[model samples]
Target chain A: MALVEIKNVRKNYGTLEVLKGVSLDVEKGEIVTIIGRSGSGKSTLLRCINALETINSGEILLEGQSVSAKMDGLRQMRQKVGIVFQAFNLFPHMTIEKNVTLAPILTGKTDKQGARKLALSVLERVGLADKLKAYPEQLSGGQQQRVAIARCLAMSPHLMLFDEVTSALDPELVGEVLKVMEEMAAQGMTMVLVTHEMNFARNVATKLVFMHQGRVWEQGDPKTLFANPQTPELKSFIGHHAG
Target chain B: MRQFSFSDLLFLATALEWTFLMAAIALAFGVPVGLALALARTSGSAVLRTVATALIELIQGIPLLGLLMFFYFGIPVLVGKDVPTVVAVGAAYTIYTAVFLGDIWRGGIQAVRQAQWEAGACLGLSWLQQFVHIIAPQAFRIALPATVGFLVQLIKNTSLASVVGLVELARAGQMISAGTFQPLLVYTLVAAIYFTICFPLTTWSRTLEARLNGAR
Candidate 1:
């Protein structure tokens, strides 16, 4: 079974259909990058994977278990699926160390001392070991995004979702966040990301999914999909991004 | 006419304790009740939101003096017994504080970005856990200045307890003024005493508000 299975999912906000019959699968250790224009439902599909946005129809399965809005076992499902937002919503009141440690401790995965050690290792992974004492506001946008990723990694999730994580960073700072994501992919962590960064999508993503008008317009190896241009939509999309 | 004396000043000073006591009772009990009301107002259930909204609007709609009189005069008539002035006044202030503080805190909680709640939930925290660990602290910072401001108002409002014969600060000043026929002098001193208590609090609230805004 695929690690994450999305089968014909649909979502609507009022009369606007955001995700229209979207279906995809993320196998273990695969890095899938979803690239689309705004309002094309790329982020919505990623959010639905962890049941953040409830599906109007169809289903999402995480390792053969259904992901639903039901409170029962929903939290346990979410614990294994870590998602980082574009805005880097790190708890401002908490120190970086506290932000990384809170979930692990609250979930009983580790005690306070163990959480501290876990936080150190994860912070180190993101190359932010020096920022353990800093508040989110004290850090730059890139640094804050990295801390947000580290905060997620402390949970030891099986799958990581990045929702336009670098879209909010300054031009010079985007590389650092992408570098951290590349490292995660290199370590063979399964990831599904919605991004506007074409270079990252082209170079790092194992599988590329192009979404257009609330549907997966094309999907295949990143290089092949980008090179071949299966449809006029993909053609125009690649053309627009190339400029 | 009797002159305003040192004895009368001492009496007013003594009456200040009752004022503090009423304010304390209002705060100590009101804050928790207010929190519950806030949570209810913001909860997912429509029924909880509706009920809390109704209660808040009902309490806030009535004048505080009306509430005091209702508890003191209205309740005694219904219960067929004399209600103690302190209990009646305390009850009125507590309910008054709860509804106002509830609405204030509700706005604070709502003012926090929607993403904060989503972040907590994505981390596998339960709704209550999200509230206690994530949302509450941020909301508390947002609500603090207004809370202290409300506290100042609460202290000043405690003087209203005098209407029911509680002999709190304002009533003591009234008694002294009646006897000495020195309303201006007596009231000035009373106002000075109130200023001593409220000025620092308003300053503190402003400082807190400035620090919070600067931090953000």
Candidate 2:
């Protein structure tokens, strides 16, 4: 069964129509990379899946349960689906350890000592165990992004959504965040990300979706889609990136 | 006119207690309600937002002096009941501080990055929990300087209670000056005492502001 199913979702911001009849499904452990230009509704679609942007019409299901504010067990549903933003949104006032441990204790009733142990383990996964005592401001941008990833991982989520996670980073810092993502995918974790990194999408994604003008223009195996452009839109999109 | 005695000075000094008490009553009644007002103003519900906004504006439009008079004199006369001046004074200060503090703290809440809310929501936290753990703490930090500065203002504003016949520090000054016929000396002494109480608070507020900036 698909881990997430978004059906005919429609979203509008005031008079502006952002997502028009967007739909997709993610099978377990699949790395689905969505690549598109700014304002193409790629980020909006990802946000909808996590219920960040409410759909004006249509529905979304996670693990066969509906996603909505009124949905029963919404908290439990959220515990299984984690998201990371383009900007590292770590709590500046909290230590790295506390940032990682907070959700577990809040959502799962994990005690402080247990949460601390869990924090250390997850921080180690993102190569940040040594920075446990440091505040978000004390870390470099790359390191901060890694801590964000660790914070998500600490929840043991089944699916992770990343919204242009590397776009805000300095050119040099982008690699570290991407490497952490690569490792995450390699561990057989399910990930759906909206990214501008064409090379990473082509090489790392099992399935690549090309979004344009608030719709999925093309989608297929990453290698085949890159080798042969299926439509003039996808052709130019890829061609523009290549040239 | 009576001579200026040390006992009269002691009386004025003791009035500081009433000053502090009035200020405390204002804060105790004000801060929590102000926080509620701020939350309602920022909440997504249109009705709550409008109601809170209207209250803050209505109260803010009226000066604290007017509120003191309305409570102390207007209500008692209209209701045909004898209300203690202290009760009237306390109620006035509470409403005055709540309105002002609510407006100040709302600015602080808005100063918090929207990203923080989104991050908390993504973690599946309930709205109140998100506020308690994530949003409120950050907003309080951002709001600290204004909040403390407002408290100092509150201390000074408590002197306005004298209008309603509560002899706090400022009213004590008036009585002492009238008795001793040393207007300059008594007023100067009162001003010095106020400075002693309020200056440290102003400095503390500045220090917090500097530290907040340094943290960023």
Evaluated with TM-score, which candidate comes out highest?
2
Candidate 1 lDDT by residue in tens digits, A13-83: 99999999999999999999999888899999999999888999999999999898884799999999999
- Rate residue B61 of model 2 by lDDT: 99
TM-score between model 1 and native: 0.95
Superposed model 1: Cα runs more than 4 Å off: B206-216
Tell me which residue pairs clash in candidate 1: none
DockQ of each: 0.69, 0.65
Candidate 2 positional error at A180, Å: 0.7
Tens-digit per-residue lDDT, A1-243, candidate 2 = 699988888889999998888888899999999988889999999988877778899889898888876678877877888899889999988889888888889986578879878988889889889998898999989999999999989889999999999988899999988999999999999999999888889999999999998988898899999999788988888888983
- Compute the TM-score of each model's chain A versus the native chain A and list the values: 0.98, 0.97
DockQ for candidate 2, C-alpha atoms:
0.65
